[model samples]
Target chain A: MERPPHFICIQLPANPEYVLIVRLAVSGLANRLDFPYEEIEDIKLAVSEACNSIIAGSPPGSLILVECDSDGKTFEILVKTQSVDENDGALVPGSEQDMGLHIIRALMDDMEYLAKPGSGAVIRIRKNMSA
Target chain B: MDIKVDKRKVEEGLGIVDILGEIDVYTSSWVKEAIAEFIKEGNYNIIINLEGVRYIDSTGLGVLIGALKRVKEHEGSISLICTNPQIKKIFNITGLSKIFAIYKSEEEALAAHKEG
Candidate 1:
């Protein structure tokens, strides 16, 4: 039998003022997993960038949903936007000069962009604990 | 987030802006406005002290880049004082370490500016 991953979810208004709260929650979760300080910083930065991008591209009054899961070996976060159009600019991939996307690619072990029908965009980022 | 501009350097066409707190999307505009004010006042030689800053996002980085461009228009420069390794790593990863003058201490940055 395998142990199931523990999941944590947070839903907040799509506002920049709440970004710090998200970072604090994610940092606390990562700290509980015994992640190193430097790795924790990287995870926080990646998550912040994802949230900022979503807030920038989404319409006003949107909601952001953050999902985190870990099994002690790896941590993953899904930053999703709600009340956004399917064709919103937030869902579109950024160009080479997009520093936020670039930082996410450099810091995270893996990343994916999901554009679900009527659910806005999802930026999924993962980090391996031992890596 | 808060910014303090050094008044003593104003006469020398230099602006020393010390920033404290996280420089993310919400607070980056403050930095942009501070630098823009410096440029508008003809103080193009700017020194941004990030010693009090523990975190900075891409929007903050973009503001710094924009300030650099604005200063360059007048043949001025922007020097940064950053002691945090994580923040330094972000500059390295973005390849901004090559284009910007980053010093570990304010003394070192001021000395280099004087030498230049």
Candidate 2:
């Protein structure tokens, strides 16, 4: 049997206030990886943008899952929201009302989107650590 | 996102409006209102001291940029005194540094306002 990788996961209510705590945590993690201050700030903005996206998409009483893992050279961030109306199409960023994902895509190195059951979506990013 | 605005009587025909708080999307309206109120009251010479403000989102930047445009057209100018490096970077990155005269200290901003 293969062992799962070590990671930090947080399940929390969909709220804007939680972004600040996430910023602080990402800062610490990025600093531990010797990321430059500029990179750290980018990480903070990336996370905030992701959380804001989830808060905007999720319905009431839904959960936001945030996961982070370090593979000795790069950091991966995965944010999943278990709230979506599959009947509706994917949300568009900068379409008169959505700017969150636009900002996230600008800050992160790599981004992946997965549409899931129950109107859910998972976004994953690989944040490159400074060499 | 609380706001505290203080008006200081500077030299002849000039006043300073010092604003403190988080000027995010929600509180940015308050900032715009405060500036508009001052402009309407003919207290256009303004210097926003953001040393106490630790955070500012894009909406806040928009408010500042909007006010600068409106006030400049009326022969009035604005500057921001931001000591926080993080907030200063946001201002610079968002190009408010070039649009508005930025000073490191309130006194510097006030002196520049008087000289200009």
Candidate 3:
């Protein structure tokens, strides 16, 4: 049987200038979890990309929320932004502006983007312990 | 959170930028601006020394790509001196290793420039 995951959450203004704080916090948390240095770097890059995506897709002054959950063998992260409906379809490729999402997809083990319609879009990413 | 770009003329048409600090969304714009300023001054061949950069995100990668494009537009080149294994892995994962010239040290990159 699997154990319940421990979760940590953070909220910040949807400002591009503050994304570094999120990266720093997650780096420390992942290090505590004993993630390899390389994996920790990937985690930081993935989360930073998610925050950048949210800030680009959302309206100004909206609050950004980031949540991290960890079980013994896996780690999960969710980023919620008050922004456009990502449910329409995958964004156009090679647009330059949306490259952040593609980079996140490449770095994280698994990724999903859900749009909450009027509320915002949520980007969820997961990484296994073995990674 | 803070990024500093120190520029020095290596030769008549070459310049070096020493980047000190993390490069993320908060600081990538500053990097872009510094590179743009270098290009505006007709420093076409640019070498970015990333030895002091502790962290870089996708936004930071994009900024570098933008700088490369700007240099290429002027028929110039951008070489990277990055020794950190983590940063090198990111470049490999993103396939940026194929896009830019990467060297293990600034001296090696400078030598390669002379050879080319």
Each candidate's lDDT (Cα)? Answer: 0.83, 0.69, 0.84
Model 2, total clashes: 1
- Report the lDDT tens digits of candidate 3 across residue range A23-119: 9899889998899988898899899988887776666779888889887777998887734434446433223336677778788888877654445
Candidate achieving the largest DockQ = 1
Residue A108 miss distance in model 2 (angstroms): 4.1
User: Best to worst by TM-score, what's the order?
Assistant: 1, 3, 2
Give candidate 1's error at residue B31 in angstroms.
1.4
Clashing pairs in model 1, backbone N/Cα/C closer than 3 A: none
* Model 2 residue A97 lDDT score: 39
Q: Per-residue lDDT tens digits of candidate 1, residues B1-39? A: 333333236447887888888898878887788779878
When only the first chain is scored, the TM-scores of the models are: 0.81, 0.77, 0.80
In terms of TM-score, the best-performing candidate is 1
DockQ pick, better of 1 and 2: 1
The two-chain DockQ for each candidate, comma-separated, is 0.83, 0.25, 0.63
Worst 10 residues of 3 chain A by lDDT: A88-97
DockQ of 1: 0.83
List of clashing residue pairs for candidate 3: none
